[model samples]
Target chain A: MTMTRIEVSKTYKLFINGAFPRTESGRSWPITGKAGDTFAHLCLASRKDLRDAIEAARAAQPKWQAATAYNRGQILYRMAEMMEGKRDELAQAISAVPNGPLAPARTKSAKRPASRTSSLRLSVSPSLSPAAEVSAAIDRLVYYAGWCDKYAQVLGCHNPVAGPYYNFTVPEATGVVAAVAPDQLPLLGLISLLAPALVPGNSTVVIASNTNPVPAAVLGEVFATSDLPAGVVNILTGKRDELLPHLAPHRDIDAIFAAGLSASEAQMLREGVAENLKRVQIHDVAAIAAGEQGQSLEHIRGGVEFKTIWHPALA
Target chain B: MTWRSPTVDTVMVGERAASFTKRSIKNATKRELLTLALSMLDLTTLEGKDSPEKVRGLCHKAMRPFERDEQMLGVRLPSCGAVCVYPSLVPTCVEALGTSRKVNIASVATGFPSGQYPLEIRLQDVRDAVNAGADEIDMVISRGQFLAGKFDEVAEEIRAVKRACQREDGSYAHLKVILETGELETLDNVRLASDIAIQAMDDVTPSGTGDGNIDFIKTSTGKVQPAATMAVTLVMLESIRDWYLKTGKLVGMKPAGGIRSAKQAVHYLVMVHEVMGPLHAGPGGSNPWLTPHYFRFGASTLCNDILRQLVRLKTGKYVAGYDFSEA
Candidate 1:
């Protein structure tokens, strides 16, 4: 008689300091499908996990920032290349969610031009299908990859001084950055939140989408193989509300970029600015998914510190 | 005096040591453990490039540890147990530490890291450090002599070093014998070295002088690979326990080097508590071995990590290494 084989299941762990580790709290929550069938388990990251990630980010930030801008661009492009190789698996994880982008009967809307005004809506506007979202996420990475070396040139400018001195302003990375991804379009939202801060050389610790974190966890695998330095980008999968309070008041986190937060959640993040005077940038999920608004020079500029220097005008 | 050192079960010792790390230390218990571990630190700087200014800075850090301890944790932290340095820097530590003496000054003498010098020079090294105002003297054993079956010579050298720790005031500077177990090659050798060192110190301790300071059997000199492993430390702790059981005398244990994390320090404390019993189980209502007086960690990088953990426990937020002083 032939025996039936047991299906092997995968455990989704947090990506911290470039390695996958179970939460120190040893707690886990389930990711259930539409019919309430549990498919996988993800670590319920605690405040300590956030703390550990920040330590790693702080340690890696200097060397990463010191790397030439062209080199950072190459690494970012590598991320996109790795993502393309895993496109099928990423699409599967995204479509596995209940009523996700791949649900039948979803109308395929005509592509909208990237704009800041249309992205201002708070509601969940019609999003692309799973395949399109995955492709868009990959493209978004490539988009930032090109900006890594050029963002400084476009954002910086020579100053007009009233003296015989040459002066100019350049943007510098704002140290470690903490981010929150949107619940809708998990992969696309994460890439949108990550690429801008990362392109500018700011190390990031991002809380993945609470409702659909499978894609973000899988993206960690891509990051590990992309030659991206460990701690450059750490991903945590747990309840956003539970992590926001800890993320906001963190003194080590130089800035915060969050998308798709409610009024109270946004308030929680803003209130923490008083503790460390960290920069807080909040955006809508729909806006982040709208490529034009999400991928822009201004987004990269938000997480940087502008430094002005003066030198003798004489040769 | 002849000694019979029992053989160690390497697998059993490793398994037992691994089990201590699995203890779920959390909440108030974790906070208490972190603070206790902080108090047991022997902030050390034994470098060839060590300067007077550097030793002074280390002494300052040893006394205060964190500048804003009371402001952040609402509890003033106890100063570190001692500051270990080269004998030449003993006077520098003395001046920087001032007369408050909250942090004792410990000096590594007898050709530390490697004890290759002649017996007379090594003993003189201990005397000079003790006279230079060091409250403790850390000496290294000649691994070559012990490994070559010359146990008697090794024991005689340790006894000579202990004698040199004596001062004009009749009180002796505490002696810590570094086994340099990394060179011992096996758990059995580590056990034998620990036993020989403890017995030699006990022999010269002057019986009925409960007033004599406690001596230590340390694991390494922070200069070798695999300086202090859990298994090696457990074997030494068991040796100390066996000595205590047979003679009713307390011998301190110091595991120097390679202990850089707060978690690892706590594991060492757990082994001490389990193998030797609770802190107050001894004859005088307290086990000095469990206290900083009998136990110490010769680790310099571990202080900031412990301070960071303590701050996290207090503020519910994680802090960065840059926030603390580099000393």
Candidate 2:
């Protein structure tokens, strides 16, 4: 008799309130690798988890916003440094899936494999290696980290009014933000959406990619080891369709940044946003993939609210 | 008074109290509990900055937690147990509540939050509050005496305050002696202090006025850090249970201070129902401890949180903080 070797798969959990906890609902779904092998199990979060994350974000937002912009910049830079250290690990997770950052789009004429095991060895050309995506994500975070302190100067303005008033408008964090990551370029896409939101000192509850979630789950390990405060950024891995209904209508969420939403899903989200008038920012997945989107200061500005202060210049 | 304080297992008391919070209360019972918890609040304002204006605001909030939505929610927003204030501010609250018999006026006296004054002054403090039309007088027992093992002295002082609550017309203001258990330190001392206070005031000279004997035993003055913790409250409730079993006189329990959320208020109700249910159920099989008369919350912010939950349940929408007026 021959003994078969068994591989130990990773157990991925929802990172909430600074702790890695299983979903309160006790439900999970399997994430299959490109080779059709089960890679990991991701926590299927519930509405209650979303509520808890919002509460944690609300509790931590004030202190985070109170921190000097320079300190926030330093923290973001540290996160980039952490990502650099975990470069190899992140690249491996992203490359595990065929529909990931490194892989080219699957064509209709591609040859089909006879067996599921042999399908893992499909002949596919690389568009970009997983290392490039991870490197781009780090560079993107560093870019946002530099913007953390400088955006205020760029976005804020000294208003010219008719009175003897020294009037100026400054940007402030828009409380708790909710972001949904795109499935393609899971790690880099998440960083692109999340970094801009955090640069303005806003706390966020992010939903990692539903299809390619291993890289996002791995990023949670970096978030934990980094000096980022607990609850500053929470990460959950699950079906976007299942989580959005709960996330959209949450009264405490100040804004939402989602990618690749269907028209109906966008409409449904808009209706939910109508209840609280939450700021909604949706990105085109294809544009983001083609590097045509998400490098602007508009993403940071979307996560911030403006306040104008006036002082008597005469006095 | 031969009733002696038993040695309390602090570990056991803590474990038992924690078990009460774990009991899952579902829709029907949860709604009922929330409403009852709302009614049990002693909507309080005890700061040095309290004035007629703040007391008036609190009184109005006590009457109408959600001015328009209370009726829309289809639940009669039964006024809270009382508006608790300083003796000087009681008259202002009384005037603010004005002709509405639904709410009572409770005044804290006896060097409240701290019983450091001379005995004569503390007694006069109780008398002045009663004269100010306080339906209930919350007096703090002298922890200095209680901690000194002067058990007899502590019992005598409670009796004095109880006597001071009496009116010339044979009606008495309901007396609620606060143990200030946070200062009592250990669970044993809390149990002992509760025993002494209950035993000293259980002699109910039947008043047709319903101003029963030592109407309630409160846990704190809300000024202490560890005010009215569940572990301490359990020991006190257990004392009430023992006193009732021995003499058949049901004494009320008030766990005041630090109980802010609606969820916590529900947990306290659960403890009351389970601890006092077997002995003190009313004629209709209702848990008698569910009423403001038998059980009360000495809280300031709890009512608004309860109102928020009530609105959510009825309107299916969570209300913003600004939706309700500041109390």
Candidate 3:
């Protein structure tokens, strides 16, 4: 008798409108491991994918903004819970790339002795381990989750006027947001940019790290299992350079939050901002990796618009 | 006269209809298709909360779909085929459209969406709209009666409403019979209902005499789920083709509701061109059904989407929904 065994490989697909779908363009790129063997394939999202993701984000923005602040907080907390449950899976995906930007910090320290010349030239900052990165991502989600219902109060204020009128300014969700995840610290950088935009009730279409997108793809799974509404958080796994040109000039996207973009990419985004007057916020990779600056209230403020209302005051 | 409608081949029809969507229409031809689709729209507002201002806004949109057309696109778009509304709003449409007559006024009558009302009352509804200056009457067929196999009663009611579409001046308003195909349940039923509507309208006024304004057989009332699927529309177009071939009498087609994108509109046009023929007389004789005089799309949201695509073609930039007027 002859027996055959087969390995069931995972097919990483794009998360669009709350469902997993292959790229409409029918294109895929291989993800290689440290041994230079193709371990998985990721969908190479096209302009059409960016269009669809923006459409989904626009459609979901109104309802997501309409949801009570408390409910939004609860959903964010639920996302954190889901992330906590998927901690082991996320760490494993991150650790798969031993020399990639998302590799655990200790791996680089362990490999330091073998390449003394390279180590001498390279400045190495202490980064989190895979397990620690996952934990920080979860904590970052909870941090923003707690800020959801309270950020508006802290950001909005009443203005004292000389006339018999009451003026008040309040921050509202800036509609659909497009985010570019950092190539370094893929999971935490993505969550850091994503959580702030989400805290203001803005629906997001995030382009995951091009080189190491598996961790972000796994985060999409966590998002699906959580109570977040479909289209509210669409994740596209593709090259940021290919998608940013389309994302910048998109008329429907109200704001863009990108991290670790090259000078040319950042310049292209800033130029495209002139098309629709959409706000573009670019952050340094070091700032995002610092965790302190990335998780601040000012980051949350980047994805909202201030609407000042004037009402007649009665004596 | 008694009529026997042909049964539709469901599988073949589905395959044929799906093939039309696979055609890749590009650049100049795509722009032309988008412009033609813009001309074929029936910008409609059929809500109970509809106001005179709303009807006027719809008429404005129907007349000039894109206000910046000349400046941005460098060509003025053709006005939409008509502005469809409830019977009560016909006078407002007449007032808004004025005497330019660029856009026709189409009113939904005969207890629209559900023709369950009494026949006499439904006929009066038709008369009221035509008298108030509606150029077209979109009357709903008695679906309940048609389903109960009272085909004669349904046909008679349609004939009565077509007659009611006549004004004192002896000019007849083109009648569109809505079969509400979503409730019809099968492609065979859709074909039969299309035949019944075409024959009933022709009994009052003979079609295909090059009159340009022929009667139509529409697919849905825009209130039902699964309104105007391609398979259902194809069956109705086939009914029209067979009628034209047999008696040289042409009937129009309108697939309202659920058609909201420019890409889908292009597919419908492809299906129409292949199943019916060319738009006008050239080397080959014209397929009259391809013209706005014979084809229409009853949609409110479809207008902005077509405009978005047209702008994308001209300016090379994708536009937002809010960039267009909400009406």
Candidate 4:
């Protein structure tokens, strides 16, 4: 019961929408780590963190689509009990790997600080976690938050009520996502790309991982201290070949996640997403480093609905 | 009765250019040996299992310049060099090719194409590809003593893998002597194993093995699929144009395995300009470091279908697929 080690990053700077400032392109670099305790200078995520992550994803897109899918699956199962009460400062902030783990205080101070910063001891292995990789990425968005009440009952199709009236197949919301992440587990691959487009209610902007942008601006200060209805997961950080051609040709970005690139950078992210035929996915950053984090939630396209719920049949 | 109306462009450029008359090396036609036996659908024999990073990710999707959508049906065949792998992948084939596209890393030794090793494990696979940086060594001549005829124990195990490719950092490599043209089945033993591999690249003794040993004579090592042809590269480009007209020096000529694509690299550059003429068409025009020592297309999906036909003409997007997802 003796928690003490703090030099928690010497006045770093770059968070963006949840505010840390000082980068609006005035540069400032270094973060070093393997614990020679570096973090020097830091900044660099401007064009105003892509206009404050697209105006905090257009001012938290209608209160993250009016919150309730059972209170957004209890705020994503209370972000897995706030990532199991900070599993050792998220495994000493992403440990690159070496013996400094299997913790008995990193295997007894890894046989006494034996040189070259033992890849700064990050193996939070009780079977790996940074909050169990954001609690298996929000128990994988509460198993797609229990398929937003049964994935439109066995994935859509049922409509021939012609005269009486009652159509079907509904799981919409394929709008505004933008993602880039995958710079090697920088905040669990940017929470497996902002939890499948903010747990299906959409609104995202994520650029993150220009070699770990200060642990993704400390996950935008843990989604601006949770109840995330503001900008449903905007992220930002720095340089995805300079913010993926403004979110792969953004016309208010309908879809783009991109992920790793190569097969000629995924054919230039399918020709920088030929304007608005935009919805590109590509993703395979080695299949999200082989766990395929629910492969970008079946390419999240809840963008298909026909809810014509009108009741005026002569009372 | 003169055969003297002999051209008009200097009577068809003065009678002959040189060696264009066994009625022109029987002018190839059986529809050019069925387009050289359909260059065996652009041959891609990898034998590459147990990953050298899946053979350097099939050598960076067969020497970069990529695309291949259809389940990676991989035919990128332009990478006609390097890819003899295993020497912990000689810096994954010198970091997967492209520095003015040279590419020939070969390393096979006596054990290859069954010469059955133990000349100090074929001089430790040619001194482990000249200490992991091979540019060619491909041994193999003890087809159990050239099928028991023992041409002096296959020219002293190609002079001890060309004396374990002579190091002391003058770094000589090109040795290649795999005449398993399916066990030398006569073009009179493939012109005496192409004259003892062009007399071991014109010896410069100390029991000579490296002055870049035998820069070219490789006929087969795709472990014998009709071990390299065009009648063994027209009897090894007529023993390298009769050892460059009796030793004026020009020595390369590599006819490797079922020569795969870009129309079998223009049907072996039209059979090296129809057998030794337009300056013995060696990678065309005398020699540009002699195109990895005179042409080689030992395929692995013809360098992934010439990098998926230069990425379907630089991303005009026609993705069909050819393997890069072992799902």
Candidate 5:
């Protein structure tokens, strides 16, 4: 008879307001693998947890938005560096998911475009190797990091009006944003959704992928180790349906990025968003994963509000 | 005469306070505790930019905390215990809370947040606030004197301020001597200051004056860190409990600053119940120390948090920060 020692596993908790607090309700659900073996016990967050995250994001957004754009770019780049440092851990977590390595696309275009605004040729799909996915995520972060301080120059405009005025439209972060991660490509999907929202200095409260949340929970360390200020990117692990309804109608949340919501879930979110007139965006994650939906300025603009200022043209 | 201050074990005080946070409060019981905590708040605004308009806004908030969302919910929310402001701003609060005697007017005097001024001026500050229709005066003690081991001078100053809290017609305004525990440096100093204030107020206050006894012993001025930690408040509450045991007069306890949430406020309440419950039982086996007359929260933002909780309980929807106006 051979004796084997059991491996110790870490429990995942909700990240809110700069702290990893267990769910105030003290509820936990087992996250199972393909063979029906429990991988970990993730916190089953309640509505109160959602409320607390929103409050933290709202409180932190103003200060985050006030930072200089160059500084914001530096922090996003630091996140990319943190992700780079934790490559092996993230790859292992992503590969552990069942059916994680689907039919791998044979293309190897995981390189940064020579020109800014040139299309990124990332081989993003379920079959993409975990290393390639993590590589794409880091490059994608750097791609947005290069855009953070420069987006305003491209998106902003000085309009020629009939009157003597300095009329210009500038972009400002829409206060607090809520992002829902996709289940299939947890690591890449989370990074894609979060990079654009954070590029323009918006603080986000993310609902991590329910089925494969270890990748997202692993990214919590990425966020903490990076210089991203506390509460800028809070992550919660729970059932999407249980958390989405509360995040949808929250008046403090200015915009919601709920990817892969079903037709019914979409309708429910739209109805809830109407209560506060919040900006809601639903994305096709599969299309993005197939190299079709690489993030651009529009995804960045989606998390921002345009401010048109008219100053008197004085000599 | 020689003087002695009771010995305080910081480790014991901290351990006792930490035990209270472990008590489980939930569902209906949690909601009830939140409601009780809301009623004990001294909605404060002691800023250098204090204005009559600001004080009036705070008074309105103190009186009707959930006014913005009351009609939609069809539930009546309770008013806080008092509107606390600067001495010159007491008239504004008094006029703002006019005819609504349910909310008392409290003023922070004695060179508030920092008690560095001379005794005569400090006492005059207390007198001016009381004359301006303030029913309670929150006076800061001389931390410099207390730290220098001049316990006699510290005690005498509290007595003089208590005397100053008396009005012309023999009616007394309640006095709350602030220890500014953050500046006291150590838990032993915190305990000694609390003991000195309690003894001084007890000596000056007539025995068994019913509701007119030396009103409260407060924790901080809200301008310092380490303000109103459970350990500091536990030491103060223990001092009050001991005084009550000796003189049979219940003294209220107030922990101000850095206590912004309903959870922290309820923990303070639990500590009070465990420490002072036996001596201060009200009707229906309830701890009388939980009420505003025997306990109060010196807070500015706590009212809105409690209002949000109340509205959330009434309607299943959580209220946003914008739903409640600033105090």
Candidate 6:
């Protein structure tokens, strides 16, 4: 059922299980992104958002599981279709990567994809326009969407069980993942998490990129408009250290994802995910900066639920 | 207080700018850190990180004598909210300091000073620090890949570290990721790192990654000669404040390394005061963040001078420096 919108100075609803609630910590912040041209008032997810995420995970599990796996695949394909239709209007959602001075070098180097690793890339460009970044992001997301049907087949391997269990493991989506997006690529990176998981039948909760949360929030409008399921995605654009623990080791969550974490930060997730055997994938900046594999690795390891069935032939 | 020396150009901002600035920020030129203390141009938080066990030991030797009501140094500020030390020594420090005053312990992880280690080992170290009772944790990123422009790997590593600190408090330990500004190589890189840290701090997918993660925007590890300096401090403060004003969520700041004297510590305080303003941090030691609750100097020898100055003021006569160890 559709719910009535609550009155407030700004909207930073806790994107829990699949609904929006104010953070119990009752904190908020202003986000300045988009070439320093806009401000998107955001709410720091308090303990409440974490709780809400857990509750949402619990509520959505049965439906997600009950949906036929084939049907789930179809929905993702549908999302891609919708994205294609709205690419013109949702230019920011599917922003294309820029073709700058480095473009020539990258164009030439595009032939070699294996030489990359983890490290930080700190480049500031006052010239980077909001429109340009968003365009690049849209292109990036569209690329991931195309990979939805193909990646699992290409990346996942067939499992050979000892018994006649009919066991062949297709790469499954990590369920109800909680992710913290990078500060700069608000639209692009957050979309990276959403499309990958939703395409695979898993829902996700994202802490919007602090600086560029405006576009992520804008993307939420797109999600709501796209016939996306109620619990398919939730976003809490708030403080990482504060909101994450609530989501970490949450009885309902199966995995945890953080962007640009330190050793200490990486350790926290490793430990939190260990409690429930939730898969934890930490990004290696050097490898990523080198760009051999983006967040898709984390998407695979973030956490997936597998069903093992048995049969007897006594009939 | 015309405190200067032949080896360094501590305070570049002179009397003219000082008039516009404030006296609380004097002697800030050492690393050019005072810029953080002079204005509300950035969102800054005080940072005190303790790694080598030796540093925490020094804090105790210096702090205990003054706690008892007998004859001691006349310094007034309480020990920093948290005494940062290596994870291995947290239990010892916590017990030694006693539970009377809440002094938190901060530990460094992920092959600090040089980010060279397997991802598994890095997380293991942080977990070990939390197990050892570290109230806060500091970590360094892999500079090698970063310098090579591996943004994704950098973003992912920071994200993983934050995930490891899970406890009933939601944070097994407060996490602070160090960017080591000296290595980032440029104002643009520093700004980008700041952007990443701030986002990571807030748990967002930032343009640059690291939003405000790990807790503090630390400048550098002491091992790097110049350490966490003022240029980075200015840049970090500017980034944090820029995010804060736009978001309304307060982020913290910490400039570590190359800090050797109380006067230098005071300059950092002055810089923090000037940049983010008093609203930036809560009560010093009263808050649970630990030594340098809002601001900290990662020093190994600040005790002696603090004592000498206090004695000089209280006795009304110049006193010779004494061996604090034997005392």
Clash count, one per candidate: 0, 0, 0, 37, 0, 112
Report every candidate's CA lDDT: 0.86, 0.82, 0.86, 0.55, 0.82, 0.54
- TM-scores for all predictions: 0.91, 0.89, 0.94, 0.34, 0.88, 0.40
In model 6, where do residues sit more than 4 Å from their true spots?
A: A1-315, B1-56, B62-77, B204-214, B278-291
How well is each residue in B1-327 modelled by candidate 6, as lDDT tens digits? 121112212243233224333353323242233212211111112234534345545446534423421353323434444565655666766666676754566777776657799988988888887877776778887878777877667767877876775544554466677888777776567777776766654663222223322366677776676676655676677677777667755556777766554455555555565666734433451321122434455544454445443443444222223324411
Q: Please identify model 4 stretches exceeding 4 Å from their true place.
A: A1-86, A91-153, A156-178, A181-189, A192-212, A216-238, A241-243, A246-255, A258-271, A275-315, B1-140, B143-196, B200-216, B219-246, B253-293, B305-327
Q: Where does candidate 3 stray beyond 4 Å?
A: A1-5, A98-126, B207-213, B278-284
Scoring only the second chain, what is candidate 6's TM-score? 0.72
lDDT of 3 by residue, B43-150 (tens): 888898999999999999999898999987999999999999999999998888888789999999998878888889999999999999999999999888888888
Q: Write model 6 residue lDDT over A1-315, tens digit each, in one string.
A: 989998664464555544565676777676543345334456677665655555465457557646665566555555555555554544542232221221111122222223321232223321334555455455545555555556656556655666655545555655566666655455555655555555555767777765445555555555665555676677776766666555555545666655445445555666666756766554432222222254464464445555444443243
Give lDDT tens digits, candidate 2, residues A34-134: 88998777888877787778778878888888988999999999999999999998998888866544322333333444562132222333245689989
Query: What would the per-residue lDDT of candidate 4 be over residues B240-297, giving only the tens digit for each residue?
Result: 6766666656666666666544345445555565555555433335532224444455
- Report lDDT (Cα) of residue A164, candidate 3: 93
On DockQ, the stronger of 1 and 4 is: 1
Q: Give the worst 10-residue stretch by lDDT in candidate 4 chain A.
A: A97-106
TM-score between model 6 and native: 0.40
lDDT per residue as tens, model 2, B1-327: 454778999888899999999998887787889888988889999999997888899988888767876465875677788889999998897788887567899999998878899999999999999988899999999899888888888989988888888887867888898999889989898988888888777544433224454468899999988898889889998898887777666778999999999899999999998988877446576666778888999997788788878877776655555567886
Per-residue lDDT over A1-315 for candidate 1, one digit per residue giving the tens place of the 0 to 100 score: 988999877878999989999999999988886667886788999878887888899989998899899999999999999999999989988888753332112122423344732443455573778899999999999999999999999999999999989999999999999889877788898899899999889999999987789999999999999989999999988788688988877778999998776556666777778777889998877777776776898889988999999988985
**Per-residue lDDT of model 1, residues B1-327, tens digit only:** 576799999999999999999887776987887788778889999899999999998998899999999999999998899999999999999899988788999999998879999999999999999999999999999999999989999999999998899899888889999999999999999999999998888778856128768889899999999899999999998898887778777888899899998889888887887777753446676666667878999998899999988998888787767788866
| Candidate 5: tens digits of C-alpha lDDT, residues A161-268 | 878799999999988899988766788888888888997889999988766888888888888888888999998887887888787657678898865555456667
Against the true structure, whose DockQ is highest?
A: 3
TM-score of chain A of each: 0.91, 0.87, 0.90, 0.32, 0.88, 0.68
In model 3 chain A, which range of ten residues has the least summed lDDT? A103-112
Two-way DockQ contest, 2 vs 6, winner = 2
